[model samples]
Target: MKIEIWSDVMCPFCYIGKRNFEAALAKFPDRDDIEVEWKSFRLDPAMPEVPRYQENMYQFVAARKGISYDQSVAMHEQVARMAENAGLDYQFDKMLVTNSLKAHRIIQMAKTKGLGEKAEERLFYAYFTEGKNLSDDAVLTELGISIGLTATEVKEALTNPVFQHQVEADGAEASRLGAKGVPFFVIDRKYAIAGAQPGTEILKVLQTAYAEWKKDNPGLIHVRQGNTCAPGNDCTN
Candidate 1:
C-alpha cells in the first residue's frame, strides 16, 4: 500500500494526523511493504519567513480575526494538549509564522533521492519542537545530514532550486484533488481522508485500502489485524 499525505509543519493537526496514520500502519498485515510519502502544503502562502513571537503574533492574528489574544492562546492550548496525547509536544511559542514554499521545494528534492521522509521528520521536529528557522541553510543542511544525505548533496539540493517545478507540480496536483487543508491523506491514490481524524478513523481507511490491494495481489499475506485501537495503540487493519 502507498500512502501519500499532504501536510504543513505549522499545522497542529498535521502532527496529530501523522500519529493517527502511523497507528493505522502499525496494524496493517503488510506493514513492512507499505510505502509512505509526505507532501508539502503551505497553509499561509503570504506568511513571512522570520520567527513569530507568541505574544505579538497571537495579538496580531487574533485582532484580525476579531478575537482576543486570550482566545488565540486558548486555541493553541487545545492543540498543545492534543499533541501531548499524541506523544508530541508543539512549542508554538517557538514557531515562526513563515511561508512554506521553500520548505516544499526542499521536500520535493528529498523525494527524488528517497530521503523525503527523513527530511520531513527533521523539519517538523525542528520547527515544532526545537524552534529552528526553516529558512536557514545551516538548519536545512543539518536536517539533510541527519537523514544520512551528504553535506554537499544537501547544499546543492537547496541552493540550485532544482525542485522548484516539482513543488509547483505537487501544488497543482493537490488542487486537482480538491485538497483545501493540510493532513490530507490519499491511500493508493484512490481514497482520501482530510484533516486529522482519530486513530480509529485512519485505521479503518487503511483496512479498506488493504482490502482493495488484496483483490489485485491475491497471494499477498495481509498483516494480522488487532482489536480497534483508541489513540495510543498502533492500528493494524
Candidate 2:
C-alpha cells in the first residue's frame, strides 16, 4: 500500500490531517506493508521569503481574505480547537506568515534519505506549535538536524536550486492530480481523499485501496501444505 500526501508546513489542517492519518494507520491490519511519501504543496508560492509587514497569521488572514481581524482570530480559534483534538498545539498568535519554499526544499532533500516523514512532522510542529519561521535558514537547519539530517545537507537543500526545482515538480504533480489544496492524499494512485477527514474515513479508503491493490498484485499461492518454522522460529502447520 503506497500513500502519497500533498501538504504544506504552514497549513494548520495539514498537520491535523497527518495526525489523523497516523491514527488510522495505527489501527490498520496491514500497516507494516504501508509506504508513505510526503509531497510538497505551497499555499502561497509567490509569498516573499520574509513578510513585508510585521503582521501575525490572524492579521495576514484578515488582510488576504478581506475579513476583519477579529473575524480572522475567531476562525483561527476554531482551527486551534481542531488541532487540540488532534493532539497538536497551534499557536496562531505566534505563527509567522511567510513563505514555506525553504522548508519544502529541505523536505524534498530529506525524502531521498528516507527521512521525509520526520521532516514533515518536525516542520509542522515547528511552524504550527512553536511558531518558528519556515523561511529562515537557521531555523530550518536546526529542525532538519533534529530530524537526522546534517547541517551541511540542510544548507545544501536551502542553497541548491535543484531542491527548489524538486518542490516545483511536486506542485506540478499535485496539479495534475487535480488537487486544489493541501492535505490531499492519494492511495495507490487509485483513490484520493481531499481535506482533513476523520480517521475512520481515511481508514476506509485505505482498506478499499489495499484490497484492490492486493487483487492486482497478488503473489504466488501455495500448492501444498507443510509444517515449517516462521522467521521468528514459531512453527505452524
Candidate 3:
C-alpha cells in the first residue's frame, strides 16, 4: 500500500496525526509492504522569514483570527492537551511563528535520501517542542545534519532552489485535491482521511485500503482445466 500524507510542520495537528498514523501502521500486518511519502503543505506560506521575538504564538493567533489573546491561549491550551494525548509536548509559549517554505524544501531533499519521514519528525519536534526557529538557516542545517544529512548538503539544499519546485508541486497537488487544511492523508490514491483522526479510525482506514489493494493485486494463480477420459473407453464415447 502507498500512503501520501500532506502536512505542515507548523501544524500541531499534523504532528498529532503523524503519531496516530504511526500507531495504526504499527498494528498493520503488512506494515513492511507500505510505502509512505510525505508531501509538503505550508500553513502560512506568506509568513515572514524573520520572526519578531516580541510577538508570541498566542498574540499571532489572536491577531490572525481576530480573537482575544486569552481566547487564543485557551485554544492553544486545548491543542496542547490533544498533543499530550499523542505523546507530544507542545511549548506554545516558546513556539515561533515563521514561514516553513525552507523547511519544506529541506524535507523534499530528504525524500531523495530516504529520510523524508525523519526530517519531517525532526522539524515538527524542533518547532513545537524545542522552540527552534525553522526560518534560521543554521538551525535547519543542524536539523538536517542530525538526521544523517551532511551539513554541506543541507546548506546547499536550503540556499539553492533545487527542491523548491517539488515542494510547490506538493502544495499544488494538495490544492487540487480540495484540501483546505493540513494533515491530509491519501491511501492508494483512492481513500482520503482529512485532519487528525483517532488511531482507531486511522487503523480502520488502513485495513480497508489494504484489503482492497490485495483484492486488486492478487498475484499469479494457477489453474487446472484439463478433461479426463475413462482408461478403457474410447475418446469418442
Candidate 4:
C-alpha cells in the first residue's frame, strides 16, 4: 500500500501527524509492505523570512484565526504539551516564520535522492522546533546534505528549480480536491483521512487500506528496495 500525505513543515499538526502515523506503522505486522510518500503543502506561502518573537507569532495566528490572545496562548500550550508527549520538543516561541514553497521543493528533491522521510522530519524540526528559515535555499541545501544528499547536488537541484513546479502542482491538486487544511492522507489515492488523527485511527485506516490493496493484488506485496524510509521499509520502492 502506498500512502500519500500532504502537509506543511511549519504546521504543528503536521508534526503530530508524522508521529501518530509512525506509531501506527510500528504496530503493524506488515509494516514493510507499506510505502509512504510525503506530498508538498504550504501553510503560509506568502510569509517572508523573519525572526518572529514568540508573542508575535501567536498574535499573528490569533489575529488570522480571529481568536482571543488568551485562547491563542492556550492553544499554543496545548500543542506544546501534545508534542512533548510524542517525544518532540516544540519551541514555538523561538520559531522563525517563513514561506515554505522552496522548502517543499527541497523535500521533493530529497525524495528523488531517497531521503524523503528524513527530509520531511528535518524540515519540520527545522521550522517549528529549531527556528531555521525554511525559505532560504542555502539553509535547505545544507540541511539536505546533512541528511544524506551532497550539498553540491542539492544546490544544483534547487538552482535548476527542478521540483519547485511539482511542489506547487501538489498544492494545486490538493486545493482542487477541496482540501482546506492539511495533514491530509490519501491512501492508495482512494481513501482520504484528514488532520492529525490519533494513532489508533491511523492504524485502522492503514489496515483497511492494506487489506483493500491486498484484495486487488492477491497475495502480492509492494515491498521494494529503497521504497520508503522508516524503521523497516525499504527506501527503493
Candidate 5:
C-alpha cells in the first residue's frame, strides 16, 4: 500500500504528526510493504525569502491571525508541550520564519533518489529544532548534503525549474484533494486523514485500507499441486 503525506516543513504540527504516524506504522504488521511518499505543501507561499528586518515568529502569527502577542505565546507553549509528548523538541523561540519553497524543492529532488523521508525529517528538524532558515541557499545546500545528496545535486535541485514545478504541482494536487491545511494523509487514494490525528486513529485507518487492498492483491496462490509427501517423509507419490 502507498501512503502520501502532504506537509509543509514550517508547520509545527506536521512534524508532530509525522512522529505520531511513524509510531503507528511501527506497530503495523505490513509496515515493510508500505510505500511512503512525501508531498510538498507551502504554508505561506507569499512569505519573503529574506525579511527586511529581524523576524519574530510569534509576532508574525499574532498579526496574521489578528490575535494578541500574549495569546500567540500561549498557543506556542501549548504546541511545544504537545511536541514534547511526541519526543520532539520544538524551539519556537529560535525558529526562523521564512518561505519554505526551496526546501520543498530539495524534498522533490530527494524523492527521485529514494530519500524523501530523510529530506522531510531533516528539514523539519532544521526549521523547528535547529532554527535554520529554509530560504537560505547555503543552509539548504548543507542540509541536503547531510541527507546523502551531493553538493552539486543540492544546488541544481534548488534552481531546477522541474523541481520547482513539482513543488507547485504537489500543492495544487493537495488543494484538489480538498485539503485546506498541512499534514493531510492519504492511503491508497481510498482513505484520507486530516490534521494531526492520534496514532490509534491513523492505525485504524491503515488497517482498514490494507484489508480492502489485500483483497485485490492476495499472496501465495497455489497452482496445480501434485501429491506431495510431508517434510519427514519421502517425495514419492
Candidate 6:
C-alpha cells in the first residue's frame, strides 16, 4: 500500500500530524509493506525571503489573518503546547517567515533520491525547532548534506529549476483533491484524512483501509484446464 502526504514544512500541524501518523504506523502489523510519499504544499507562496528577526512569526501571522498580534501569539502558544505533547519543541518566537517554494523544490529533489521522508523531517526540525531560514541557499545546502544528499546535487537542485515542476504538480494535485489546507493524508488514493488527527483515529483509518484492501484483493487464484489433463486424468487437475 502507498500513502501520500501533502504538507508544508512551516506548518506546525504538519509536523504534529507526521508524529501521530508515525505512532499509528509503528503499531500497525503490515507497516513494513507500506510506502510513504511526501508531497509538497506551500502555505505562503508569496512570502518574502527575509529572516525572522526582521519580523517575527507572530506579527506575520497577525498581518496575514487580520488578527491582533496578541491573538496570534496566543494561537502560537496553543500550538506550541500541542507540539510539546507530540514530542516536538516549537520555538515560534524564533521561527522564520519565508517563501517555501525553494524548500518544496529541495524536497522534490530528495524524493527522486528516495530520501523524501528524511528531507521532510529535517526541514520541519530546522524551521520549527532550530528556527533556521528556509529560503537561504546556504541553509538548504547544509540541510541537504545532513540528509545524505551530495553538496553538488543540492546546489544543482537549488540553483536550477529542475524540481520546480514537481512541486507545482503536487500543489495542483492537492487542489484537485479538494484539500484546503496542509497535512492532508491519502491512503492508497482511496481514504482521505485531513488535519492533525489523534493517533487512535489514524490507526483506525489505517486498519480499515488495510482490511478493505485485503477484501478487494484476495490471494491469487489458480484456474484448471478442462482439455489438458494430469497423469490421473482427473478434472481436479
| TM-score on alpha carbons, each prediction | 0.85, 0.91, 0.90, 0.86, 0.91, 0.89
lDDT of each: 0.77, 0.91, 0.90, 0.83, 0.91, 0.89
Q: How many residue pairs clash in all the candidates, one count each?
A: 8, 0, 0, 8, 0, 0
Ten contiguous residues minimizing lDDT sum, candidate 6: 220-229
Model 1 residue 179 lDDT?
A: 97
Error of 2 at 32 (Å): 0.9
Winner of 2 and 4 under TM-score: 2
Writing each residue's lDDT as its tens digit, candidate 1 over 85-117 gives 988988877776666766676677778789888
The deviation in Å at residue 74 for candidate 5 is 0.3
Q: How far out, in Å, is residue 196 in model 1?
A: 0.7
* Cα lDDT tens digits for candidate 2, 114-161: 999999999898888788888878988899999999999999999999
lDDT score for candidate 4 against the true structure? 0.83
Model 4 lDDT tens row, 1-237: 888899998899999989999999999988888898889998777666653443366877788789997898899999999998888999878776676777787788888888889999988888778878766777887888889988877776577665787888889989877778989988887788899998999999888988888899996845545546667764545
What are the C-alpha RMSDs, in order, of all predicted structures? 8.8, 4.4, 9.5, 6.2, 5.9, 7.2
* lDDT by residue (tens digit), candidate 6, 79-140: 99999999999998788888899899889889889999999999999999998988889999
Order candidates by lDDT, high to low: 5, 2, 3, 6, 4, 1
Q: Report the Cα lDDT for candidate 5.
A: 0.91
TM-score attained by model 4: 0.86
Worst 10 residues of 5 by lDDT: 49-58
- Candidate 3 lDDT over residue span 57-139, tens digit each: 99888888899999999999999999999999999988888899999989988999999999999999999999998888899
Of the two candidates 1 and 4, the one with more favorable lDDT, higher being better, is 4
Worst lDDT 10-window in candidate 2: 220-229
Off by over 4 Å in 2: 52-55, 220-237
Superposed Cα RMSD, model 1: 8.8
lDDT, candidate 6, at 53: 35
